[model samples]
Target chain A: MTGVAALPGTATLAEIGEQAVIATLTAGLPPAADVLVGPGDDGAVLEVAGPLVTSLDVLVENVHFKLGWSDPADIGRKAVAVNVADLEAMGARATAVVLGFSAPPHLQLRFVRELTAGLHAECAAAGVSLVGGDVTRSRDLTLSVTVLGGLEGRPPVLRSGARPGDVVALRGRTGWAAAGLAVLSRGFRSPRAVVEAQRVPQVPYGEGAAAAQAGATAMVDVSDGLLADLGHVASASGVVVDLRRDAFEVPEPLQAVSAATGADPYDLLLTGGEDHALAATFAAGAVPEGWRVVGEVRAVGPDAGAGVLVDGRTWPAAAGFDHFGAAR
Target chain B: MTGVAALPGTATLAEIGEQAVIATLTAGLPPAADVLVGPGDDGAVLEVAGPLVTSLDVLVENVHFKLGWSDPADIGRKAVAVNVADLEAMGARATAVVLGFSAPPHLQLRFVRELTAGLHAECAAAGVSLVGGDVTRSRDLTLSVTVLGGLEGRPPVLRSGARPGDVVALRGRTGWAAAGLAVLSRGFRSPRAVVEAQRVPQVPYGEGAAAAQAGATAMVDVSDGLLADLGHVASASGVVVDLRRDAFEVPEPLQAVSAATGADPYDLLLTGGEDHALAATFAAGAVPEGWRVVGEVRAVGPDAGAGVLVDGRTWPAAAGFDHFGAAR
Candidate 1:
């Protein structure tokens, strides 16, 4: 069967109407078991288990995304990707998501449908369902996604759990999305691989579970860049995390983009954000498979102010994605 | 203790900035039990039991609200209230809420804090806590709230369960909010009474559970006018819901606004929305206390589509709140 019409090639969110977008986005999603009712109702019910890990994220037009650069589907996927990454950082697996979308009335029904399809696709990949949401009229395009996750039998891994001697490890590729963003900003058509990464980040979805099973002490995602996120962990855990630059190998995909854009690969690795890779601290023994050791947690001292170090010196990168910061 | 700072009368959302808004919004709010981690985290872990009921709703500046008329705290409270109402409509009690906000980065921090205070106040009223959320920069102000609820010891009530001969009842005020809205539109601002109702429509929090315990065959909340929401139940159940207009009395508050606005009180009774009132079908007998009997469910006629009727005639009101319809 022909796949549902792809999202409009040039449709801005302002072009697709909100209700049509909702109907489109919800078309083919699987219903979660506890959902006595799904979309198109006053509300949705999800099957709850163990303790729930819930989070919410909102993306506004031009703030979280640019209509000129991202397609509706890409916007949808990015919305789910970032929220799901938060669940992963908490050592939880996302089971369901509810969305609230607001847009001008003139937006096309087709674009909304395609955006929902993209959301469903991403949810499927993450082993979750787009369960419930609300659609309303607004002056600007806004997307709000709330994710619910299950801890199963494991305790949640918090940012404050790292011990002084714990080894810091990462379970997914970092810096690639940041590098892709650099290419996009410079008006360069990203290569197929870079564009794919930029549109829908490849997160190590089940790795949070793996890390939890292997007794991860602390975990955070690289949505705010490695050093910045680690700094949060350091502050919360009262430890200093030192990263060996030599150990932070750039993924091949990012290296190519860096060469093409003539951007400093190291800056992309340390300062660029939105990679959504999982970074965690584990005990100083064997780490989980598919994870690379990059640093060690040290006791806070005179030279360290509960922060991160690069090589043997304190690394100074602006603390990640501040909403009001000039760069953002 | 000193109360939270009042918002300056002339400050716009664009002038208040994002982080300052977040800091302001979160100040002085107490946390709930399920919230292992609150705001300032990648995601919050909320303890869930049985199944989780989750939903999201977003309000945009200039479309959903006007800064010239309403305060940020009013907007924040409304955002949380509506989402919590959704959960309640599903026969669930809210446990936590996560907020996603976007605005320009020039507004004062105090205004944002007051908004957060309002959000927390509403969450407290609903027996839930403010957990994790995201903030970002946007050209317009937007508030997105995702609420997580617990469906303790009961299956969720759906719209499809009403049978012929079931009696219909309502558990909260229906026309007050709409009446308040009419008052506001006519520039009749009595901030102490009419305008406050429009800003925050009081919802009967435990009434959903009361209705559920009293054996409601089907249920919904009147967020989209009485006739329209009943139409959903009728269509879903393949039955006819006939209302006795004579039996429905407009409350005093609504009547006062109707007198002031020179609007039809009946229009507010039948077509007005956003009262957050719970409406349900019960088996023919004594319904719960605090609930007023309003209608009866009947088998659909051969020529009549399963729908709603008033005063022995088909109700002639527009279907409620279409996102693509003209803005209010």
Candidate 2:
């Protein structure tokens, strides 16, 4: 959903104040039965159906996102989507979320209202509720979202469960978001789909549970590039993963962006993060529909070196997003 | 516990990197049965005993707190304490907390470690677990804490249940923290107890459940000053709360701070915030032990005005912390 556009004479946060801004941001959110108590209380009460699953992600103004590069609504949507991906990785359906927002006092109140609208839209798409949150003034804009999900009678799919001979499968596209970033960084206009991918990733949400039901041994959401994230599963399971580069064909859109920007398509596909793709280890020949085989889990060498190998070679260390060490 | 002294050779976050920093921050924390899955996964899995009570609060440097005025450990502890207070207001015991931290890349790794130590110490104090979190790089320091609690088979004590003839009671100190803040703001060395009160409030954590069991009608934590928070109860319950000035005597420490700072004692007592005290209304003459009677809840006036009345008159608006409107 497109959030309400900023209008002339829209009150700034300083002019209208915190209470009024909060009242506007929380107004007209659809109520849920699980949310016995909503915003404005000390805390919220949720009647979770089963065990609770949770994840948290923080988005800083320029570190995780650039305000000029994305709309306020898209920022809010992306914030929710990223946290929801964590829940899906655990084979849980998101039930509710609480957001912590900080912004400057002179910021437009309309921005917060629109951001909330976007949060509502994304939560609706993921079948989650915006139950409660806290808003405060800061020097820059920051959004912290914590999502809660319910594991309705299914065992959690952990990253440490893959066994030797398990086949690694991928359920969503890779490199599109990174390709879009390459286009934007170079001051070139890319296809709308590529740009949207960079802004708000469309996670294959329910497939996580489907994979679990289909007997996936281990699962992880690809937030830190395909190789880097799968390396987590490999390391945790004490196995070595050998990925076949040929298994992943460069998509036409990414190829176009690579030609336009003179960037390597393989770099985007292998090292680009925030794809939110589901990568899992399933029994050989048992990969679920909508998922394609990408690699195989094997026993570690006699030296006990556990890692992700592309065509049986070691990849670079720190190949994905490292918040403190890497330059954005 | 005193945090590790910043050594001459202390590593900066950039040098230590995100992965190593995270590893050091999470090492050796106690585990809990409810935490079926802990950090290092996509999310944490919590076997909530019953209904889930959750709240979120974000503390920004120079906004909600100042690094110069507070120790990093105390800042971490206070962040968890304030959020736990919200759950305590709901007659819940905190079970787990998730934290989101953002800071500049050049920040010391020891600072983050000490912050985590402070978080661990506070969570241990409250019998809660630090389940999972996310960290990123930002221009300024910010900590967002989300507390999850359980009601333990009891109904949540809501703010909307106060009826006419209910007596208002308070379970903890009112003015000490605010007085401490006054002293800190004035750049005067306050008493150790007073300064500590301001930095890390000692909440009457379990008194909320006791109040519920004792038939308390309405409840809230006195975070935004006595009168302001009680106003929430009054508005939610549609009843007028009248607080008597003579009923509360000026504490000796507050009186000393008032004399030293030349601030009005009544202003500090009435409008001071961050006390983390439990304020509730119970049946008249049936207030529980450890609670001092402060006021009474009465029916709305013939004019239908429902709010907190001090000495039978309306208090000034914006008397407490309003993040956007207040002149801090």
Candidate 3:
């Protein structure tokens, strides 16, 4: 690392080197009970149990978000939220996360520090530790997070476990992130709630374990929109998901966005991605408090294939977020 | 994901969508006994014990390696090697790895498939499984690997465990990768041994556990040169690492490269990064059979702060690779 510390104004990562950047990122990170040895070591030693669940998610510049629209701190927070959602989707307790960050040398040190702040903040909110990670130089800024999870003694509530006559319920926001994205895309930002929701998802953190304890038979996070993610459950479980039109009452923020933008509120609710909401199927009466019954799982009919149908039709727009489908 | 299958010639990831690409990368991945569930889920459920060790490493295009200098498969294999090395550094057996990869939309489908091949082959060699990961679109190709390992009721060998009078030893090749890099930089790629080392490091697999079992105190993989990495151990342990000049026997390939390129062989051996070799501090008589003694851990003197010293002075050249310090 450079002997000179990164000064306030014009300091870039190239001038300070990697070791210094790492030191800045890991400083004051929250400690966890499972972490025996955290950052500054070759690897972190965590007190974990068998049946550990793990997932990885990557967020890249321009592809995932434009720096012009979202703050660096928000990007950092969103990265952690999106990754932890996978653990939540599996009915596993979000344990710890390790971030792999790389950016151009010329990127401002301020951005890096702000991103660190966001990561630390989100980790605290999710009850997960930012245990350890790698930082290096790259052509563009990218945050790759790998989240570890614990399934305790219960079996993982898989996407393939949905059966006929099961009730599909959801906990957490749906159309809000898509509405936020739509608002941002149109160069409007007045609806602060939706905009913030787009910037950082309000993931239902503890509801994964709650749903598992409630005897949820199947689960999937609404990362790729409510309809698209349920489609995953439908395809995996070989069933048909019939979502009721009246079940989705569009929230006020989403309704406002819909009224102004001339977009369908139901479209946003059905096909929005990046919400990170928990969607699980349970027996008819097994639905827990704070969750609403949105749909029902049914055996695939002879005429119908295994898929998600909202009032017996596929989503009007594309199903959820497609990374490569979007033009950068 | 696009329903159109990737039908070989000239197909790119964008055309097929993320789901297809993920399915392609995860197909036929070798199963591990510890893995309760593999890819295709929201996350992988790996059966592990407490005291789990984990580390994340990222490799980016242009910064980490050039497409011209190495094949796609070699890049994938090297990515795993570099990450698994961190686990091994802690004397933990490499268990499973989840890769977070992103690449340009125009990247060849063939390249993606070949990289998967390399990743699988290396995972098999290291006795690890490719569990699960996320693939997205990015401007530059990046492979972010997070490796998980189990401690198996043993304590981790940390870099801070070195004490005064501990003998320093090395278990794998040091100068070869540097020599290979030097060779490649000069537009000549003959010396196959050194070139291959540069492409994919044959890390002294299983030696980390052996060192730990033999009561080796402190250890680190020589990823960022012997001097620079040992400098980390010295700083962490608050000791001076005094290395012997005659202790290092420059290999024939390094000698040849040194003779051909006018680069110092010893300097390459001492300051070259990315060797992925294990360096450890052991008691004088407790040095393992495969490792050769190179230095001794000494108490920091008043004249010298905690750092690595070659013979009696610092090396002539600047210490190992500083990512941002290099000219891209």
Better of 1 and 3 by TM-score: 3
Which docking category, incorrect, acceptable, medium or high, applies to candidate 2? medium
* TM-score of B-chain for each predicted structure, in order: 0.90, 0.93, 0.96
Q: A1-328 in candidate 2: lDDT tens per residue?
A: 1232333337677776677766766778898878888888888999987789999999998877778778888988999999999998998888899999888988887787778788889988988888888989888899999999888889999999999999999999788888878877777666777888988888887888888888889999988898889989988898998888898899899889888878778878887888799999999988998899988999998844788888787755438788897432
lDDT tens digits, residue span B129-189, model 3:
9999998988888999999998767799999999999999999989888899899999998
Candidate 2 residue-wise lDDT at A45: 91
Per-residue lDDT over B276-305 for candidate 1, one digit per residue giving the tens place of the 0 to 100 score? 888899998858998899989999887566
- Which scores higher on lDDT, 2 or 3? 3
Best by lDDT: 3
Task: Give the per-residue lDDT digits (tens) of candidate 1, residues A169-280.
Answer: 9887777777777777788766667766766688888898889889999999888788888988988898889888888787777788888878767778876678789999
Give stretches of model 2 more than 4 Å off. A1-9, A316-318, A326-328, B1-9, B316-318, B326-328
Model 3 C-alpha lDDT per residue in residues A40-121, reported as the tens digit of each score: 8899988887689999999998877789888989998999999999998899998899999888889877888888899999
Interface RMSD of every predicted model, in angstroms? 3.4, 1.6, 2.1
lDDT (Cα, tens digit) per residue for candidate 2, span B1-328: 1232333327787776677666766777897988999988999999987789999999999876788888889988999899999998998888999989888888886788778788889888888898989988888899999999899888888899899999999999888898988888889756667788898899887888888888889999998899889988999999999988888899888989989988878888888889899999999867889999989999998954778887788765427688887342
**Top DockQ model:** 2
Arranged by lDDT, best first: 3, 2, 1
**C-alpha lDDT of residue B261 in model 2:** 80
The alpha-carbon lDDT assigned to residue A186 of candidate 2 equals: 78
Which rank order by TM-score, best down to worst?
A: 3, 2, 1
DockQ of each: 0.56, 0.71, 0.69
